[model samples]
Target chain A: MPTVRINDENVTFNEGATVVDAVAQTTGRELTAEGKPADGGRLGVAVALAEEVVPRSRWAGVELSEGDQLEIVTAVQGG
Target chain B: MADMSLPPLQIGGYSLESRLIMGTGGITDLAALEAALVQSGTTLTTVAMRRYSPETKTSVFSMLERLGIDVLPNTAGCYTVRDTLLTAELAREALETDLIKVEVIADEHTLLPDVIETLEATEQLAERGFTPLVYTTDDPAAARRLESAGAAAVMPLGSPIGTGLGILNPHNIELICSRASVPVVLDAGIGTASEAAAAIELGCDAVLVASAVTRAQDPTAMAEGMRLAVEAGFHSARAGRIPKRQHALASSPMEGRIDLT
Candidate 1:
């Protein structure tokens, strides 16, 4: 099991789990719609892996590794 | 004079006809927000970036897109340069726009922009090809620093965020506007239509308001007021206001006095 950090929370994933899986395990939220994985974060969510921002299109291609840091961001209300 | 066109408010590469920019925070009602956004005629509005929450049903971005208004993501709650930069990067990626409002706040109570962190974040964001609209104090020197660091615009606070104090330091805001080569948007602390108008009359390129309309009893009416005030302010700035005088000068000519005749 490879240990990874999603936005600073340490978690272990099965071998070869991608970035989207790590996000779901850590945040208990999906980047995609419940039934729709094709449309990822149409609601303006962003992710950065190890401090380097990765767009939604590349989420599935980027696999998680040991000690990988993932930062998740979404749009919320503010002044 | 009535039909005179107001000068466009230009920031970065985008030129907006409306001198009013809105913030989406503090407005809980989506329908009301839609009405306010429409009535305000704001081309660029602010949205804050946070972690995705499945519980939250309303999406401000969807509303913005439906209305055809441009979204300007903000680093509103960030306190450190690193956090601000990260949030800004995420915002740029999420929004798919280079435009960002850099707000490195001091504390929870005041919510004022931290000068050092703001400048640092602005520089890093600018280097990354982002157009940062920096929020800073009314200090003219601070505004100059951000502009020198490649900020698209210098947004000086009229007072604290959401305080509605309305231009606490007119001279300071004026000084900032005078020295600023980029657009000087009077951000935050606007109480009503007059404050928005007054900010523009003080030479601000535009005025950013959120609570004044969002929290108002009738948000729709307040939004309309802000829109009209912005237009009025633009025209008043161009119409050439009379110089201030210690004593009142009679509108009627002295020669028109019947006793003198």
Candidate 2:
């Protein structure tokens, strides 16, 4: 099992799991490699792993490592 | 003059139809925020990035999409260059736009922009192919440095964020607007529609309002008022106001007043 910190919460994933896997599990929305919802809807989400922004195209290729810190963010009401 | 129209605001690669840029903050109700957005007639609106929560649905992005308003992602709560850059990167990815509002605050107490960090962030973001709209203090020198640092637009605060105190230093704002090569957007502390108008009158290219409209008692009405005010302000700015003097000038014919004597 690979343990990772996602949005400040610890979560253990199966071996060879990737960033998309974590996002799909946490958001409950199956996402494409482009990070769009598989249902052809706008996801409006972005991911940062270890404080480095991970582009949507590389979400699946970047495997989760032990103690990996991930941040998934979306739009909120702000100035 | 009756058929005159205000020119569109050109910032970076976008040509904004409205000079009043609305901020979608402090409005808890999504429906109300939508209404305000529509009523404001703003071609662009700003949104902040935060952690995603499944329980709390975010229709903000979808709503903006439906309304056809371009999103300007901001680094609102970031206090350092590292955090600001990360936030900006996330915003660029999430929003799929190169437009970023570089807001590096010094502290939470005053919510004033850290000019040094903001300058650094602007330089880096611009280098990364992002159109950085740097929010800064109403200091002419700082504004000039940010412009030189590759900011697409310079947004100088009239007062602290969320204060609604209005433009405290009109002279400084005027100076910044006059000297800047890029667009000058009056960012914070606009309390009413008049202040939005005042910004344009003071040579500001645009005005960004958040708390003034979002936290108003009647958000929709205030938004509409702001729309009208911005238009009026634009026209007034070009209309050329009368010069100030210690002595009052009579509007009526001075020669026709002899009958009263």
TM-score of chain B of each: 0.94, 0.96
lDDT of each residue in B1-261, candidate 2, tens digit only: 367766898888878788889999998999999999999999899999999897554578989999999999999999999999999999999889999999999999999999999999999999999999899999999999999999999999989999999999999999998898999999999999999999999999999999999999999999999999988888899989988999988778767555654
B102 Cα displacement, candidate 1 (Å): 0.5
> Candidate 2: which stretches are off by over 4 Å?
B254-261
lDDT of each: 0.83, 0.92
Please list the Cα RMSD from the true structure of every candidate, rounded to 1 decimal place: 3.5, 1.6
Candidate 1 lDDT over B121-224, as tens digits, reads 89999998999899999889899999999899999999899898899999999888888889999998999999998999899989999999999999889999
Q: Model 2 — TM-score against the truth?
A: 0.96
Residue A40 of model 1 has an lDDT of 51
Per-residue error for B217 in candidate 1, Å, reads: 1.3
